[model samples]
Target: MSRLRSLSPATDEVLGEYEIAGPEAVLAAVARARAAASWWADQPRKGHLLRWKREIAGRSDELAELIAAETGKPRGDALLEIMLAVEHLDWAARHAAKILGRRRVGSGMLAADQGAALEYRPLGVVGVIGPWNYPVYTPLGSVSYALAAGNAVVFKPSEFTPGVGQWLADAWSAAVPSQPVLQVVLGAGETGAALATSGVDKVAFTGSAATARKVMAACARTLTPIVVEGGGKDAMIVAADADLDAAARAAVFGGFGNAGQTCAGVERVYCVRGVYDDFLARVTALTKEVTRDAYGPMTIPTQAEVVRSHIKDALSAGGRAVVGGAESIQEPFVSPVVLAEVPADSRAVTEETFGPVLVVNPVGDLDEAVRLANATSYGLAASIFSADQAAARAVARRLRTGAVSINGVLGFAGIPALPFGGVGDSGFGRIHGADGLREFSRAQSVTWRRFAAPIDLMRLDRNPSALERARKLFRLRHAR
Candidate 1:
C-alpha cells in the first residue's frame, strides 16, 4: 500500500500528515457505497433534499472553518462557497422535477399507436475526484447535483484538503443517518485511479487537462462514463466603452482571488487600445491594494514552481510588469502581479499558470479583442465588459465556452439558473443548474402501447404478405 501524502500550506515549511485509505480499502468502501445507493435512492426525493439542506445549513460555521483551513482562503471567501453551494442545492431540488421527471414525447408516424416518454435516471455510483483549491465550492458543484439527481457519490478529495472532504462526507451522512451515499476516499493519485476503475457507473473529475486525460484512459478500461472539468486559461475582455472601475475590480479579483489557483481564474486580459492606458493604470492601482494575508497561503504548494516559471518566462519574453513584477514573491503566498505588453505567444498567455498572475495585452478594437480572447485551447468561463448589450451578447455567443458574463464578472457562476461547464480542452459536462442535474442522470426512454396494433408490424413471425400489404397501404396514401 502506498503511504498517505502530507498536506501543508504554500507558506508553511512543516507538513501536516494524514493517513490515506489504501487502494483495497478504497475499493471496499466504494463497493459498500454502491450496495447502499439502492436504498438511498429509494428514499423520497423531497425528503432527501430537505435533509441535505438541513445538514449543510446546520453545520454552516464548522464547514466554513474547515473549508478555510484546508484551502487557505479568507473566511468570507470560504462562506461564499457554502452560500453558493446551498443556493445550487436549493435550486436543483426545487427544479429537479421539471428537469428530470418523465415527459411525454411524440412518436413517429410509424409508431403513432404507441406513447413514448423520456426520463432521467441516476447512474449507479459516481466517482468524483475533487481538486484542492476551493475544496468546498468546486467539488460540491458535482456532489450536490449528483446527489439531487439520485446518484451515490464516492468523492476523492485533493490530498492537500482531505480534512475538508471528510467533514463534508460526515455531515452529509449525519443528515441521511442511514446510508453512506456520499463517501470520502482520502488518498493521492493512486486512490483516484482505483476509484476510476472500480466498476463505478461514472467519473466526474476536476483538475488539470493532463490529469483529465489520464482519468479518461483509466475509466476507459472499465468502460465507465466520465465528465472532465479540466483547468482553463480563461480570458477577460475590456471594451473602450466599458466600466473601467468595475472591469478593474473584476479583473483583479478574478485573476488573483484564491491566490489565483482557480481553473476559471482570469489569466489573460485583452483591452481596447482607446482605454488601454487608463485601464492599465486603474488595474495596477487595484493590484497594489490587493495583498495576500499570511493566513491565506498557496492552496497547492507544488504549484509555486509553476507560478514562478510563468512569471520568469513572461519577463524573458520582454513583457513588462506594469504593476507587480519579480518583486512579488516572498515564500508561499504570491503577491498579486500584473504583466503588461506581453506577447500573445508567451507561456503566460497560452498556458494556465494557475497563480495570482495576469497578462494584459492591447487590442485594436472589439473585433481584435474577441479574437484575442478566443485564442486559447480552453473554452471555460469568460468575461466581457461592455455597455452595448447587443454587442456583448453577440461576441459572447461567438466565443466557444460553457458560460459567459456580459457587463459583469464571475456573475454567471453565481446564478443558479445558468448551466456551467466548458467546451474544447476545458473538458465537457456541467456542475451547476439544470446542466449539473442532467450530468449525473442517464436519459431513459419508455414506450407504452395505447392500443393493440391493427397489423403485426413488430412481430418477427410476420410473413412477406403482411409486409406487402403495409407497403401497398403506405403507397396508396402518398402515390400522388
Candidate 2:
C-alpha cells in the first residue's frame, strides 16, 4: 500500500504517516457503510448522534491540537472551529427527526378522495471529500448532517489533514461500537476520485471550484448526486451611513481571520465615497497591529505564490499596499496585506486569493457598491454594513449570493439554522439547517385512495359522460 505523510506547515515537522486507501480500500469502506446504512437508518439516530457529539466535545482540545498541527492554524482558531462544529452537530442531531419525519399533506381538489403524505429517506451511503483549510468544521457540516439524516458516510479528508478525519471516524466508532456507520479513507485526490465513483448514493465535496468540477465528473459516471461547497471570493460592502469603526473592524477580521483561508471570508471591500478614507484609515491602522503571531502560516505552500501573484498584480495595476506588500510572504507565513485603490478588475479583487490580503476600493454610492460587489462570478456570501437596517436588508436581497451579513461579516455561517453554500462559480447545494439535513436524503411521497370517486373516469366503456362532467368541472374551477 502506498503511504501518505502529514506535516506541520508551520515548521515542516512530520506529524504522522497514513496508509493511502486506493480504489479497492475505498470500495471496501463504502461496502461496509452500505451494510451498516440499513441497520443504522432504521434505528433512532438522534441518541446515537448526540452521543457522538458528546464524544467529540469531550476530546475537542485534543482534536483542536491535531487540527492546528496539521493545518498550521492557531490553536485558538482550531478550537473555535471545533466549537462551531459541535454546535452544528448538536442542532442536526436534535432536529433531524422533526425535519425529515413523515408528515401528512392535504390532497388537492382533483384528488379529494385520496390521502397524501411525504417524508425524506436517507441515501444509503455518502462519500465526503473534505478540504484542508478547514480540517474539522467545514467537513462536519456535511458529515454530521449526513449521519443525522441516517446515512452511512465514508470520509476522505484532505491529504494535509487525514489525521483529523481518522480521529472523527474513530470517535464515531467508539460512540457506536456495534456498526461502522462512519469510516475514513485516507489519501489524496485519487482517493477522493475513487470514493466519488465508489457507488455511494451521494457525494458531498468541499474544495476549490476546479476540483469540484473533477469530482462532479467522476460522480457523473455513476449518476451519483453531489453537493459542492466551493470556495468563494466573498465581499464586504460599506455604506455611507455605516459605522466606520465597526465596519472597519469587521472588514479586517473577516478578511484576515484564519489567515484569510476561509471560503466565506471577506476578500473584497467596496466603501462608499462618504466614508471611504475614514474606513480605509481605520482598517489600515487595525491591520498594522495584526502581528505575524496572530495567525499561523499558509497551510498549503503553493498558496503563498498565489497570494504573492495577486498582490504583485494589484500593485502593478495602480494599487497601493497600505499595510504589507508581496515581501510579507515569507514562505509558509504571510503577513497581513491591505491594498487600497485596487482596480476592481484586478485578480486580487475578482478572484479568491485565499490569503491574508484585503483589497479596499471606494465606490460612488451604495448602488455602485452593490454593483461592484455582485459583479464577481463567484457568489458565495457577502457582508453589508449600514445604519439603516431596512436598507441593509434590501441590499442583502439584491445581492446574488447564498448568504449575507447585515452589519457583521461571516455571521451567517455560525447560525446553524441558516443554509450555507454558494451560487454560480462558487458551486451549488446547501449545507447546514433544515436544508442541510434534507440534502443527504431524498423525499418520498405516497398517496392512497380514501374512498371511491362518485364518477369513475378511468372506465373506458362508460367514461364519456363522466369525462364530459370532469371537463365541465375543470373549466368551472380553473378557467376564468
Candidate 3:
C-alpha cells in the first residue's frame, strides 16, 4: 500500500505514515460525502454543528499537539491556529442559517403583483486543497464555512501536514457521528487533482499561484467553480505619520512570526523618506532581538532553497541585509533577517520569500510607498501603519490587496466576520463572514404571483389598454 509520510520538521523525526488515497479512493470518498451531504444538509441549523465547534475549543490542545508534530511549529503557534479555527467555526455555524436563509425583497413596479424572495442553497459537496504553513487555520477557513453552509467537504491537506487534516475530520465525525459530513483524502498533488475533478460541487484551493493555476485548470475540465487562494506577496506600507514604535513591533512580529511562512506575513516594507532611517533602526533592532528558538522547522524542505535563492538574488542585485545575512538561512529553519535598500525588481521583493526575511526600501513619499506596494503581482493582504486615522484609511484604501490591517499586522485575519481572500494572482472569492457563507451556497431568486392584479401583463384579456396606460405612465414619469 502506498503511503504519505509525515516528518517532524524540528527534529527530522518520522511522525507517521498515512495511506495515500488514489483517484479511485478519492472518487469513493466524494461519493460517500455526496450521499451524506443531503442527510447533513437537511438538519436544521447545521445539526448542532455549533456544539462541535465547542468541542474543538475544548480539545484544541490535543489537536494543536498533533499539528505541532506534523508541521513542526511550536506548540504555542499551533494552539493559536487552532484557537482561531474554532472561533471561525463557531461563527460560521452560528451565522450560516441567517446569512443563507430566505429573505423578502421588494418587487419592482413591473412585478408589483408578485412577491419576491431571495435565498441561497447549499452546493452539496466541496473539495478543499490547503497549504502546509497554516494547516489548521487556513484549511478550516474553508472547511468550517462550507460545512456550516450545508455542504459536505472533502479536504485534501498538504502532504506535509496530513495529520492536521485527519484531526479535523476525526473531530467532526465525533461531533456528528451520524454520517460522513467531511472526508479527507491524503496524498500529494495527484490526490488533490483527483478530488478536484471528482464531481464535487466546488473546489477551494489555498496554495501557491503556480499550483493554483493547475488546480484551476483541472476544475475547469469538470466545469466546477473554484475559489483560488493562491497565497500572497503581502507588503507593509509605513507612512510618514506612522507610529514608529507600533509599526516596528508589527513589522517584527509580522515578518518573523511562524518563521515568516505566513501567507499574509509582511515580506516587504515601504517607508516614506521622512522617518525611513528611524523606522529602519527600530525594525532592525527588534528583528535582531527576536529569537528563533520558539520558531519550529520549516514544514517544506524545498522552501528553504526558495528562500535562499531569493536572498542571493537580492544580494546580487545590490540589496543589503541590515540584521541578517545570507548565513541566516539553514536547512529546516531561518533566522529573522532585516534587509535594507533591496532593489524593487529583486526576487525577494518581486516574489514571495516565505521565510523570516523582510526587505525594507525607502520611498520619497506616501505616493511612492503606495505605488511600490501595489507593484507586486500578489495582493492577498497588507498592513498600513499610520498614526493619522484618516490618512491611514486613505492609504489602506489604495492597496491592491484583499484585507489590510490599519494599525497592526494580521488584525483583519483574526476578525471572524471579515472576508479573507485575494485578487489577481493572490486569487479570488472570499472565505469568511456573509461572503463566505454565500460562497458555499448558490443563490436562488423566487417570484410568485401573490394575488390577482387589476391588469395582468401576461394575460390576453384587455392587455392593450393596460399596455397603453403603462406606456402613458412611463412617458409621464420618465420622459423629458
Candidate 4:
C-alpha cells in the first residue's frame, strides 16, 4: 500500500507514514459518516457533547507534542493553539442548542390567522478541509461547531500535518467510544476534493484564496453548499497617541507568530506620521532582539520560495528592510523581516505573504491610516492602537474586516461569541458562536392555520359586498 510521509518542517525528518486514501476510500468514509450521523444526531441534544469537549481538553499535553512533531511548531506554541481550540469546543458544546433550537416567530397581518415557527435542522454530514498552520485551532473552528450542530464530520487535514489530524481522531473515539462520529481522511488535495464532491451535505474549507476557488468548483459538481475561510493580507494601524511599546509587541506576535502562516495574521501596518519614527525604532529593536532564525519553519515547503520572492519584489521596488534583508527567507524557516516604504502596488503589499514579514508605512492621520488599511482585497482581520478608547473603537469599526481588535491583534478569534470570517477575496460564510452553529444547520419554517379569516376571500362564491369591505379595511389600515 502506498503511504503518505508526515515529515518535520524544520528538520525534514520523517515523523510517520499513514496509508493514503484514494477517491474510493474517501467516499467510503463519507458513507460511514452518513450512516452514523442519524444515530449521532438522535443520541441527545447536540450540545450534550460537552463531555467530549472536556475529554479533548484533558489530553492537551499529549496532543501538543504530536502537533510540534508534525507541524514543526514549538511545543509551547502548539499547546497554546490546543488550549484555544479547547475553549472554542467548550463554547460550541455549551451553546449549540440555544443557537440552533426551534423558535416561534410572529406572523404578519396577511397571515394573522396563522401560527408560525422556525427550526434549525442538522445536515447529515459535513466535509472539512483544514489548513496546516495552527492546525488545531483552525480545524476546531469548523469541526467543533459542526458536531455541536448535530452533523458528523469527515476531516481532511493538510498533508503536512496528518499526524496532528490522527491525534484528533484518537481523542474523538475516546470521548464518544461508541460511534465513529469524526473521521480522518489522510491524503493530499485530491482527498479533500473527493470529500467535497462526495455528496456531503456541506463543506467547510480553510486555506488560501487560490485553493478556495478550486474547492468551490468541485462542490459545484454536486451543488453542495460550501463555506470558505480564505487567506488575508491583514493590517494594523498605530495612532500617534498609542502606546509604542504595546504596539511593537503586538506587531511581533501578529506578523511573525506561527512562522507568520496565519490566515488572519498581520502583514502590513499604517502608522500615524507623528509617531512613525518612534514606532519604527521600537519595532526594529524588538524584531532584532526577539526574532530567531529557528523560531519555526514554514509548514509547506513551497511557501519559502513565495516568501523569498515577495522579499525580493519589495526590495527591488525601492523598499528598505530596516531589520532583516532579502536573504531573511532561509530554507524551511523564514526569519522575521520588516520592510519600510514598500510601494502600495508591490506584490509584497498586495498579496498574502505567508511568512514572518511586515511592511510598515507612515500615514498623515487616522483617516489616511484607515484608508490605507481598507485598500486591500482581503477583509479578514485588522487591529487598531490608540490611547483614546472611544477613538480607537471608532477607527476599528471603520476598517472593513470580519473582526478587529483595539490595541491588540487576533484577539477576536479567542472570543467564541464573535463571528470569524471575511468578505471579498478573503472568502465568505462564518464560523464560531451562534453564526457558526446555524451555518451547519438548515432552517425549516412551520406554519399552522389557526382559523379562517372573517371573509372567505379564497372561495369562488365569495360575496362582492364582503370583498369590497375587506379591501376598504385593508386600505384603511395599511395605506393610512
Which candidate number would show the highest TM-score if scored against the true structure? Answer: 2
**Candidate 1 least-lDDT 10 residues:** 6-15
Off by over 4 Å in 1: 1-17, 454-456, 460-480
For residues 1-480, could you state the per-residue lDDT of candidate 4 as single tens digits? Answer: 679999988888899999988899999999999988988887674444776776777888888898988877889988899888888988888888777788999998767888999988889999999999988999889999999899999999999899989888878887787778899999998889899899999999999888999999999999999998898999999999999999999998899888888889789999999999999999998888765544578888899999989989999999999989768766887788999999998889999998899899899999998988899899999999999999998997898999898998999888998889998889899999899999999999999988987766767999998889889989988899
Write candidate 1's Cα lDDT for 312-412 as tens digits: 89999999988666667665778888999988888899899988898898999888877888888999988999999898898899887888888766787
Question: What lDDT score goes with residue 152 in model 2?
Answer: 97
Best by lDDT: 2
Query: What TM-score does structure 4 among the candidates reach?
Result: 0.97
lDDT of each: 0.84, 0.93, 0.89, 0.89
Where's the lowest-lDDT run of ten residues in candidate 2? 454-463
The reply for model 4, stretches above 4 Å from the true place, is 45-48, 458-466
Estimate candidate 4's alpha-carbon lDDT, on a 0 to 1 scale.
Answer: 0.89
Better of 1 and 4 by lDDT: 4
> What is the lDDT for 196 in model 3?
87
Question: Where is model 3 poorest over a 10-residue stretch in terms of lDDT?
Answer: 454-463
Reference-based TM-score, model 1: 0.94
Per-candidate TM-scores read 0.94, 0.99, 0.98, 0.97
Q: Put down candidate 3 lDDT per residue, 1-480, tens digits, no spaces.
A: 798889888777888889999999999999999999988778875556876787788898898898888877789998999888878888898888888999999997767899999999999999999999999899899998998899999999999999888888888778888889888899998999999899999999999999999998999999999998987888899988888999999998888888889999899999998899999999988887877776766778888889888988998999997987779877778888888899889999999888888999999988988899999899899999888889888988998999999989999777889999999889999998899999999999999988887566786676688889888877887796
Clashing pairs in 1: none
